[model samples]
Target: MTAAAAATADGAAAAARARTAGGGAGPAGAAAAAAASADDDPFLAVAVPPLPRQLSAKVQHAIISADSQLSERLSEQLGLPRPLILELMRFGAVHYCPVMPKAGPNTPMTPEQLAAASAARAGAMARWGPAPKLQVPRRAMEDAPATAGGYARVHLQPKRFPAAHTTDWRRRVLHQGPDCVVVDKPPGVQVSPTVDNVLESVPACTAAALGLPLDSLAGLHRLDAGTSGVVVLGRGGLAFARWWCGLLEARSGGGGSGGGGSSKSGGKSGGGSESGGGSESGGGSESGGRSGGRGPKAGNEAATARAAEAARAVEAAAEAAAATGGAPLRKVYRAATLSPPPLGRMVHHALVGTRRPGEPAHTLMLAVPVEGSAYCELEVVQVKPIALTGAAAEEFGPSAFESDIRLVTGRTHQIRAQLAASGCIVIGDLLYEAVSARAAHEAAAGERAAHEAAASGRGGGGGGADAAASSAAAGDGGGGTAGGEAGAAAAAAASAEAATAAAEAKCGFAVGSAATAWSRAAQADPLRAIGLQAHRLAVYDPERRLGDGAPAAADLGPGWVEFEAGVPWWRA
Candidate 1:
């Protein structure tokens, strides 16, 4: 045995003897048992206790006092020493909310409205909607500090991430082609590097396992840290990677000939760009802050613009599908939910999420689902789903049903949000399921606050109402969390609660109580695994027709490649 393992064994044995002398095997005895098992396993490393957190997990909030160098203002504004703040910043624990420039009008404003806004000193807007709080890295502010009176939302917190140490990353590789490597991503480990540490991510670890340079593999698409599924990584040099990214760019609205304005970009990153992103808006302010990129230098701006246009198109498709009850689905998903819609029914609902700067404003979408909608939408078509009874249902405890989702529009959290909107919350979806339920309560609180503020004459217009709605101002998804922005909260109208709830009975499993639910959902840890999985993935020729968008296509890809992951953790 290794010296460290031997020492641990000896200590554990000594503890066991002491416990035996006192009474029976107790806590020490449990430790001893674990140690003994570790020794027996050939692969087991020396048991080490979890390290205690050195910094507070509670997120610190602040605003730039004035126009100053961002690094210089950190100590005074956030109340931390300059050196310590610098250390945390280097470790990727510091972030600032990006000031999303208001989108210019999509259509001409009414003259009456313009005159009223001019007279009242209120800025004219397409819609007074959810201003998603997007957090990008400190470098953005360091490079360009805000001007005086600009909303500078600064966030400081310690990033504590669990190490994803696997000796056999090669086993996780699903397809290793000449140009790309597809892998079945595990939950908890990030697809990209977190802000604080880069070595613990899937791409880095996988490259290390394959005896390749750390920068050799770059993710083409990223799954959430909590989500387990298919992840495609670009392999080899810059030329092939560029070609692959360029090829994927042709994909849009499910077709091959590539009509004008139908091309979509995957927002491919190169040159190891350390632009931290996470959360719903997918920017620098990740739930677990992250950054870094791979491959040769290439401008991400064009790709980003294409992605924005694609997002707008998806929003349109989703809204139209919801209104028409169905559309030609492109992605198929099978997930376990608390309540499943009727079998063979083209169950449809619009999914919404706010946008940040550089992102296509939710306001740009031509068709909107909910009233004053300031976000995206998605579609789900006919499905053959069944009850997850027997062991699967038992795993769910109270009740669980299986649903087949064929999405005409695929966006982040599309399935989860649509399911929740249909009153079928996905099992263990930490964010949307609970957030929707909690919205009911938050909107109620905001409405009461607005009434009280208006009655008491504490403020004029939406002054008191906006402040009271700080809680609901929280945008959707992990990245669009409630924290970060102080006094920058957008007023989440009461209608959001109704729209999200769809008047379905609240699932006690998600938010039985508001306080407990807040801790679990709104502030959910990024490392916690959810009950969702990309169980199967099949990409077909853009022109192929399928019955109800089933992904068991005869053509998986250009070469007809297909992939299926292992059983879901919950099912297993």
Candidate 2:
């Protein structure tokens, strides 16, 4: 038979096999038959072209040279799949065709045809388009600063801070950690200079101190200028948010102890002593057996040694806490007030009726009256009663006194408002009623002097000055608190009381004489996720000499109010 007849016969046989393997009749079967008929080479028909190397050396070089955007641009230009491009970059391969699984064996391509198709596809995609202008990734890796173990210590110079500031603020190590920092901000210094009149605003101070870039440090918390306290500084953005949330949650009893958002700030900086001996057992079976075997004296001696060691450890821990301001940091303030005894009592009582929502019902307060009303020690402030009359009486009752109160709560108009609300307004407080009395006194005196001087013009000029002086004196009670804003006193007291009350209320308590029930809840519940409540805080005005014997306790009238640090038990 001729070559054409031979080819036709071969194709027909392959078609029959293809039809049988591809199930009866349809597009798949027809295509398979066509494929089978296409290959009928007499000899040397098995060998096919090698796989095409599409992405040429030039193409690869172009990709590498194009800025960082080359990969992205190339993918878009070629319409090639990302996986394929990634595969090429990773494996240095141009094309990938999945190997077909063999079932009953009606394959579309023989080994020879398979080889040819793979080569042709690879070559087509290679040199596809003008390589896209590579776009660079936005995030650039920065050089690590002077850091170790998530802490970066960078020195800041004073010049970098705000201008027109008194005193040279020195440069120091801005201790930056992953979460927070312990910074030593100078007294009367603003943290962020641009933020007008901020006390100990360390943000600008931090940047200047470290000689780093601006806006590098953010003040996590604030400290009053006169009252120094530690402030937390967050490092990166993510860590900042986490640490902030962690603090809020832990203090509020939602988040577990991430670091230390304890209920009380002044308490010892660690967990309270697990009291009641933990377990009450005097001995166990093992102890009994050991005592019997080793003799009683030997067991007793061992126990004694253990107890001694434990005692030593406790002593050591106490010493460490004292040294580092670690555990149980306590403060006692010397204050002065006018109201005598029971009336003088400045109790930050739980709100009168239903607690104001969102307020910590547990109100903590401490009021220590200074002695002599003139001289005292331990940071005592002198307070004098400013007499009131006329309209002032209608405004702020008839009595009010003024003095600076060292407050813990930074609440709104806490001290002044609380004091006034307690029926003892701070002297010279315009918000209350003292201002009107001073005005009345000045007006009366001015009229009397004017009538006397107008008849003769003698001492007439001096009357105006006298009136001004009296008004100024009345506006500012003699020897009153000068430094710090006046509103702060009232704001501080109210805030401290509010914060404490809110805290107490959160533990479910209402103000009443039922002390035992509230006490039990405090001891047992402990504000849910927090720890034990330490003893109520007390403010004591230490005695100072006035050329007499030991200075008598300042007349604070009656019992000074007490406060407590609501500590939380940490669950490790």
Candidate 3:
């Protein structure tokens, strides 16, 4: 019978057999015999349906007589039981040979399942081993090289760190308390010269500048190259160690944000939560409900309380930072941009919290937008030392436009992501400038190739005329870097021309009524530096915004103006 038909027939036949068995078991001695038989006979008791007509009798007979001598003999020969052998045979008849299924496509087995089946077959083969053996001849070992002891003694040069600076310049100190120093670091330099002794970098430079012995000075902290700020240095090793340990502990507790827990603070000294905390507020409690009132009581109140405690801890660290000199050193920054900021634009962003000294941590962020941009920017200045806030929430609510940020923590790559996430990516960013650079490169190469190709043919034609004019401009203009005479001349001329063009373009910007007023005010006043400008991007800032809190254009002041003064070597 076909498989489906066979299945149906087997079911009917099995039902009939059960009825017959049931009726046969009813009388006097028959009941006892049937009960005993049921205990020992698997096939008679099992509920499995029968197989196809020809196969069913043989399979059932094998199972019914599974404990008989014939069954034992068959099982010994097959390495299994009589019932298992019969079932295998029945399955082979139905499916062992390849045949198309009802469906057009074949069903696929999972790789793992297929592999497991293959492994099972292998195990079976192993059980009845013919003991197949194969040999792989081993190669003879070569004699050890002569003078092995001498070779081992040869010293190797210390490996250098790629893309990292190294110098013999180093200074060490031992101190028992906090100390600070102002290092005269070069503008195009990094505070940490090498990873091994991060403190050695700026301190070494400070030693050199002060004409102090190399072993006398020690650096406690670092500043970004473009920052050019005072670096707090400690004196003896013990003292420096104490300060370092305290600083480390403080930052880890989410109290002072820097190096490690950086991105969480969003560049604010007294980072506050939406509910208020840290240098600005206390922790473990919610700010008195605004007009919004209290949220329903759930297990969540504990979580809010915990958040508040964390804020208080952060504030403690800020207090520690401030109290170092009886008061923390105040820092100020100036940024120049393309135009004046819009009338009144302020954007608030949330600063996520990070790990404590003993815990592992990460930052969360939200960006909000603000007012304006011809070339949008903002200046980050460390305002003052304030009491710590220990309230429940540490971040601010979202706003409308893009915003620039300062760093409260020293986490890596925070500032770059923060600015980009806020919507206004910083100008002239190397790592983040992929799209713009690629386009510019393609365009420049195309123009150069076309110009060169044109020059190669037709002497004194369009190319010759252009070439002469270019030569005159390059020779006369003083606007580029030092190279060979022709190269330098060209570079110079290009630099001058670019600057002039930039100024002209911004002049065009001044035609707008808002910008025109800014220009007029600048021309009218001496202290007011007017016109559009760009920033000298710096490294050391790390904090980014995420989610709905990105900065808005409205945050930029009146003219959307910002600018940079000194050249920057390090980047955010």
Candidate 4:
């Protein structure tokens, strides 16, 4: 190997050794080791070729120009740091191609190389196929101080995130495999940190649980903070890519034969039959073996029946595989809301991002009322990869409905936005315009307060005579104002009891009980009381289909597994 490559290998080996030695120290030690092991160690440095002085000068000038006050302002606007912006520019890590403006191939450049480089870039772009690009050294960029004008689309690397809150990984793991791990992500836990916040995320937590390096874990998809559900994480880049592709295929209805919409229902039916056959076979084998004196004809018939069942099982497995296009991904969710939805299947068609009509998005909603009240309903919403025509700017009206949402397309805030647009907001979804449950409690409290004040006023008015009589009695007994004060205290205590009873009736809770405290707490923060109950119900992996037999762990493919996180807390 070349000297540079060999040095890089050595550095990597050193890092591995450090990690192994410090494994007991946990994530902090791993991070420290990585930080200390620089990719280019001066001791192992090789004689690398240097950049031409003229080109270097041009790059330096470009970096100086880009890192200006203007860049800082742009960085703020873009929600990126000023230093990051400069680094991106200096390293040419930004998306745009950097080219010299105008100088010719044989022209003798002046002392100021910036002007020449700009001239060359302009001339080259004016003429043709490819332009002479300006290259910048990464090391130079790293050492450079923050300047102003440099701006680019900053792709920030994931940093070592400190766990923001305590999380139970054992409870979270729905399925774990060599290629991936599926977790029942709790609400309020972020999928990943953003530009501003470096809070703990699902991937980070997964890494901790598995004792793997953070960089080794890749998040295949994301769920919103309020959305509690199954989150899939790939063990590595290759695994993540494969899983992501499968998810896309499933979403796009690219899976052959069984349109993506029908896969869930089909799988359920097939699974039932397969399960039934296993039970029947088990019982038949025990009975037949015990009653071993059957005639040849009877034995032949039983064998025929077993063979037929096996054939059916094989057929079913094949059908499932064809239907799912061999993709190992299925997602289902359960949501809760306040208002009752219109029962049955309803299709919601709209554009995803910009309101201006584009490839219209489609979300199929199936509403079923939750048994209890007319105000609440349970919906099973199926999102297909199908595109519908038309603008959904004003398609749905304001109504409350909870949903069992199955994602057909893994879009950002797909469930929340679609449901909100359809007038069925998930409970505790503050981002959307759903009516708050707290409003009703506030109104009730106001009415109760008014009633109590009026009643107290009436009681005070009526007690005046009693007070005067008590004072007269006290004067006769030589007790003075003390007797009047005692009488006043008794009246106040009676009023307080009456007020408490009235409050119990108003709040629909027993006085001074746990239920009363809970009611008060609910009124204080309705969001917590009635949380966004979106849970991942089940996930199916079609790639792991069994043929006429029970599936063993070895039969499962890379990134292949099924998981089910039961109904959300509200449903239970």
Best by TM-score: 1
User: What TM-score, over all chains together, does every model reach?
Assistant: 0.48, 0.23, 0.27, 0.38
* Model 2 Cα lDDT, one tens digit per residue, 387-467: 445543544455544332332322222343345344443332322222122223334445444433332332233334443
Mind giving the per-residue lDDT tens digits that candidate 4 earns over 266-347?
1110001111000000000000001112234555886565445434543444444456465334445655555544444434
Candidate 3 overall Cα lDDT vs. reference? Answer: 0.29
lDDT preference between candidates 3 and 4, better one: 4
Residue 322 CA displacement from its true place in model 2, Å: 22
lDDT of 3 by residue, 238-275 (tens): 32223333333353343332321221222111111121
Question: For model 1, how does the per-residue alpha-carbon lDDT over 144-168 read when each residue is reduced to its tens digit?
Answer: 3443322233334334344455335
User: How many clashing residue pairs are found in candidate 2?
Assistant: 57
- Candidate 3: where are CA atoms >4 Å away? 1-178, 195-200, 225-227, 240-410, 420-428, 435-572
lDDT of 2: 0.28
Query: Using alpha carbons, what is the TM-score of model 2?
Result: 0.23
Better of 2 and 4 by TM-score: 4
Positional deviation of residue 164's Cα in model 4 after best superposition, in angstroms? 3.9
In model 3, state the lDDT of residue 263.
19
In order, what lDDT does every prediction score? 0.43, 0.28, 0.29, 0.38
